[model samples]
Target chain A: MPSAEEAADAVDVTALLERGRTLATPVLKKAVDRLAPPMNTVAAYHFGWIDAAGNPADGDGGKAVRPALAVLSAQAAGAAPEVGVPGAVAVELVHNFSLLHDDLMDGDEQRRHRDTVWKVHGPAQAILVGDALFALGNEVLLEIASVDAGRATRRLTTATRALIDGQAQDISYEHRERVSVEECLEMEGNKTGALLACASSIGAVLGGADDVTADALEKYGYHLGLAFQAVDDLLGIWGDPESTGKQTWSDLRQRKKSLPVVAALAAGGPASERLGELLAADAKNNDFDNFSEAEFAARAALIEEAGGRQWTADEARRQHKIALEALDTVQMPATVRAQFAALADFVVVRKR
Target chain B: MPSAEEAADAVDVTALLERGRTLATPVLKKAVDRLAPPMNTVAAYHFGWIDAAGNPADGDGGKAVRPALAVLSAQAAGAAPEVGVPGAVAVELVHNFSLLHDDLMDGDEQRRHRDTVWKVHGPAQAILVGDALFALGNEVLLEIASVDAGRATRRLTTATRALIDGQAQDISYEHRERVSVEECLEMEGNKTGALLACASSIGAVLGGADDVTADALEKYGYHLGLAFQAVDDLLGIWGDPESTGKQTWSDLRQRKKSLPVVAALAAGGPASERLGELLAADAKNNDFDNFSEAEFAARAALIEEAGGRQWTADEARRQHKIALEALDTVQMPATVRAQFAALADFVVVRKR
Candidate 1:
């Protein structure tokens, strides 16, 4: 639990994110609009700015966390948030691009309380639109005209490649019965940590921060990303469907080899053995269709008994602390440091 | 139809292309090897450098025409072909990326007489590998360490966006009944012309040629691309399967909106009306599986009678002439000019 001061800081960070979204969204919308039609329409719908019929509609998009980190990092580097808008846009575009492709690859039908892009527009269009957005992100980064634009482009592309590598590994892991905790951590680092690290460092690079400062921020972002994923893995098992906007026990239902499951399997306890047996039986008999609520409840109990839930929760807190320590290496305004710390706390502690 | 002098020029040009393939393939292989497996494996297979079992196998790839153009353009601008190695690698990567995705999008099982990447690997792997190659292209460009590197990156990204736009339009056109000749030409320009134009101009830019010279080469490549497509369209309907490596009348079988088919439909002759009726009936009844050989021959004959075949052939020659004219605008060495002109002729007059 956060202290009173930290709670107030979280509220302040939330407002900062809200402002970041309001300011960055128009820039993002304009960038996406530059895509040729049908693509533009598809992108707009994916961003929740419009409906499938191309009419304006109110839809829930996430808290724009990555973009907020970009802006805050820029501010920490002694530049205004506006100076980081392009970085924000680029990161947001890439984030969406990954989401679009991952949904298709995972056969996910819904996202953010709405149908996925592949579900709504078909897989081919979704794939193409994702490609377009990836290109657009690079395009936007190059258009920044800063001395660091090339550097940023290279950084973003490298991170993107890492992200793809992670996704590919994730897909391959699904077919395997057991994945080590170390391998799971590395995958999460690549899958989720890479982009967040990019987001955290890109603004400082763009703001002309020195290499040391940039490196510190990158370290901060890297740990933050790990913590973020650890928390996300926890939520996948225990999160409220109303809050997560996903089906209950979504990760387990899909047999995802996420952090918690991998950790439990690596634990080698009786609960781990029993959970593995259940999964094997489920796979052999193709029995998920007849799986009962009681069975899901039992699985959850087994995971907790194996210390999967506590392991991930503790890991999240540990990583969060490391993230803050990394941030301490960078010299920034006190207010900016406070906000960054608050954001880190909010990331781990948020229910959704 | 070429004179004796021109025939000699064609042989020299063919040697140049062969030399380019030898030089560029190693560089391309190195770049692709940088991709993590199975992406690396998939890309290597797509390049015909290996087989599905990851063993060396002899597989026929095309003539490496685009990379040849890049090197030759650099030479035309008074730079050694080595100066344009990065350009060659970038263009070839982008070209292969498009081919991988296009094969999947078109449901093409074979390319260059072998199973396509998507057919051999799955669609998911194909899409990801295509994406990795696209990013790799940009990454390779940025590694050039010259002022031109940023400009080259921008040019490549712009052309890639246009290429995607063209593909989206092509997919949509497949569902349409009638499309105008002008629209078809515009689509072709975006689809085929854009990347070829980039390939032609990028080397000159990298070689530090003036903008005027670069623009002329760009025009040269644009026309050459159009002529190449015209020839390809003709071959799709009439070429022998032994040479084309595709089933005879394959485009007609797939109901592709090739240049000749669009022209034949737009001629508004009796043959055009009958051809349209046949297509409409085929689409409405979904009776392509039962389409007879005689009906296929009749469709080809009707397209010829409607002057579609002649019109496209004439257009190919016209574009070839224009391509040569554009080459004439550049004050290249006589030998380089001869080679460029020979390449243009080779594009239009090749039977397969």
Candidate 2:
């Protein structure tokens, strides 16, 4: 009976995501169109909606997961999904803004199986268009006539500041030789958790949900966000190339201090010592491309042997359980609660 | 008698700018402090308050012209200058945000006699700190408890979008060979005019001014912004390097499609033809460093012979007149009105 219920929940989650994409795309289009040309063209390409030449393309824009969370959270707070469309659009825009800038800053060449905005259009355009999208996010929130627009704007801006702060710390961490687990979690919470928390609670605020309900939703989103990052960090090293749209051991190749890598280094064993030696050698060369396939595989083996993989998996589950517990603190409709639970399960369990 | 009054107005304008800097510096400092380190450090260095080593530096941060305009505009709307401090800080932040990003985009190494943020730090850090400042601007405005906070946020966001659009156009213009004077003006209006207009009018909105007063102030700002650009364009070509902080014919050396150059190309005379040939030759080599001093002098001569220089001067005066006229449409207090008129006079006639 439990297995049967889980299967139904999976199907429902898929349908909910589809509904979110349908409701959010048109409004997102309108917001992107508000930007002038070149910026508009650059943004369209980044969004996977249009080619560099301004011709439309059939492209996938992620799973619309954040937007779906917003709509579902709003529904859980007693408003229709349509009522959360503005919040969904705002979060989606902010998310893309981060992606555009991050791609440029990281010098990443590809995203969603295509050349990134900076790679195709140049960094200057990427920076400006990212800024435009951010402004548009703010504009979209204010355009909503709800009495909560001011609060929503303030909330979104606060989350955005946290996001920027997180990005700053992430960049700084890369330069440092050592980063503590506590610092990593704090950075993840700011970088990933803040926006997700905002996405989860903004809809409730817009829906005029009571303070208790909104606070509960926020906690749920925060824990879920941390869980999502842990899962993403795991996938970064271990997920299939086809599933993750990245090379195998991509993070390891780049010497990224992801959760598992950091954890393994901190564990201090033979495997940890070997991993540290290998990473230090790579750092000295300052070239990841010099690393051979065997070296990549060996590094992964060391991480796993150091118990990094098990620890990260366990941490993800722990956070996921806490997220669920937070959701239980709220008394939403049973159906809405189930959707939230399903989404949480999807976040932690997905291969990608 | 008129000359005596003009001299008095100049002194008063200087005093007003000093007062604006004094009031806005602490607020700006507080906002910058909100950002975490590395970003906070980069911003502090950019603002001329500190050096790259985190030591204090006695450096000037431009003229604080935008903040002064905000404070004066608030006074014109019957509010105290302190009432407009948030607006002043916000506009100043937005202005610095543009400056930081522009320096990175243009590969400019120097600003106000110091290394640019990107030059001192890196482009990625510059980009992130600029984003942080922009977000801080929005956050500061929303922190105001007055009813106008929402309206102010909306107005500032609108202007920021326009400013970005202008920047996009400006970058696009550099890649194009034949930009008309009309297009250049439009670009300047967006890049330079929009923020100036926002700086000029936001205080009025925050002061709870009537619509008529706000509209007049906006128009005043728009024209003043155009006039400011025109003067800047002139200074770009012919001003003393020591005063302008740039080499003579700096705009031409970079082949920037500034207003005067665009106007000269559109003139279509013998001088225009010669200027076009010279520019085409320069564009082919893509090397400004190879040009001789005689060639630079010749290019400047042709621009003047084509009426570009004279036309720009006349246009500056014309716009200045229009800006002052727009201010006349409002019936603010006599003292505030005199300051506005004085500032207008100072804008067009300043040597640097």
Candidate 3:
């Protein structure tokens, strides 16, 4: 018999995501349209609906995975996917809001293979646009004008606080000399897991699911977010630049203390020691100005040799298994459970 | 007989602000405490509750004007002052959130005679902390978990969007050659008026007032905000630097197209024409690199000669009158109405 993973892989995730986008995009567009002139223009460009010069364009706008989670979550609670449209739009807006601010904070120039909002419109507009999107997200949720909507807004704002805390921790870690694997995981959980948890449960909560069910779905998403981050960490170090829309060893260039780096430094050996020394020296010099492509490649090789690569990959699988197990605990429809499992699998093993 | 303004001005505005601060500070501190580590530290410092080293200090945590409006609105609706605490905290948090981000975007180094958060910590922390405070504001309102809470949240978020829109317009205006007084008023209305309107009415909404009463209170606050901004504009240019905590002719040095500048340009005289030319030339060069305090003072003199100062002062009085008129349309306790008038008088004439 085929393994459970293989069975889960049979799910048509592309169709699921397409359904979510189909349902959520119009509402999302309406919210963005409410923004004033230049903000509306900037947000439109950021969403890939327009070119930098404001002409219409068909560009990548992510996979709409968060929205899919939300719609699926409402369905898991035996409600129509339409019941979750507001929640889906709210999560997507919050996700994009974070991206805009994070891009500016990280000094990143490009995203989705195009110039970032800050790069094109300058930092002020980026800040304002991110703020506008965030406010728009809250507006969308509260406009529901029900007790459940209040509960949902509370969840979103709480998750947002965690997300911001994670960003703060991430920035602080860049300047520190040593970071434990536990510390790294906590940061990742807050940064990535918290919002995903909110995305996974907010729709169900809005759909009038009991707290027990909502909490279970949130646990599923929390674990899935950890799995997703591990895969992203791996890609940051070793994935194909074409797939990631980034340069090779992109994380190394930014001197990020991602999971792989933290795990490797924790695994003590000659190779680990040497890897630590190299990173310390690079950090002390504070700039990769004198470094070359060969240097970054060498660092990546050292991390792999120190077992960082294999460890992170195993952690991803481990978290994916836990995520699926959380789904099994919830008494949802088999098809809904299967969809959640498929999303977990996709999160772990996807190239980008 | 004494004029209404003189009678209203006798209401001891300082005591009113003090009462607001006393009622609102603890809850505000509790909300700030919920923020994760470094964010909490940055926020405490920003609110003037602590020094850079985290020692407690009695800093000027604003005049608590927004909170007073919220509490008084609730009282006017026949609810206790305590019923308005959540709304007061939400508006105060939003105000500080905007200040943090705006200070960074404006590249302002000091606030209230202290280094700004961005200057003391870094740009990334400033952005993150501002975002955290905003999320916290939403959390405070929605945690009430009622339909009314949802309505209040929607109002706050809508106002927040308008606030962000106004900021966007302000930034865009900086790059343009000319801005009409009407355009400037629109921007100020969105930026300052919206939030104040929300503050003034949210408590009443939460206190179970009907829409008409809430709307009347909103109008009262909106006009008050316009009047308040006018006084702020006057202080920006010609107020004593010792009281303003800024250099003389501060707005002119930054080349701000505040109400005074816009109104003066609209006055259409030789001084207005000369002032416009000077500003246009300054914009063409795009930097005040070679400008001196004397030049800024000369610009201020030209604005005053063009009737900008007189027009703005008159405008403040007009808006204040309208704000009081809004209060007359609402049926409330006489004492409550008197307090509202007192606050309006204070806003129009306050030095700082």
Distance from true position, residue B61, model 1, in Å?
1.7
Interface RMSD of the predictions, in order shown?
1.4, 1.4, 0.9
Q: Global CA lDDT of candidate 3, please?
A: 0.90
Runs with alpha carbons beyond 4 Å of true place in candidate 1: A1-11, B1-11
Whole-model Cα lDDT of every candidate shown, in order: 0.85, 0.86, 0.90
Q: Tens digit of lDDT per residue, candidate 3, span B125-244?
A: 899999999998898998888777788888899889889989989988988878999999899999999999998998888898888998899999999999999999999999999888
Ranking by DockQ: 3, 2, 1
DockQ value for model 2: 0.65
Best by TM-score: 3
lDDT (Cα, tens digit) per residue for candidate 2, span B1-352: 3442464375578888888899999999999998999888899999999987889997887867788888888888889888778998998888888889888988888888788999889999989999999999999998774557777778788888988999899998888888999999999999888888888878888998876887798888888889999999999999888998887788988788998898888999899999998888788785668888788889998999999999999999888888888987897876777777777777888888
Top model by lDDT, which number?
3
Candidates ranked, most accurate by lDDT first: 3, 2, 1
Alpha carbon lDDT of residue B316, candidate 3? 98
lDDT by residue (A186-284, candidate 1, tens digit) is 888888888998888888778888778877988888899999999999899889999999878888888888878888877887999999898777766
Question: Residue by residue across A256-302, what tens digits does model 2's lDDT show?
Answer: 88889889889998999988888877777756787788878888999
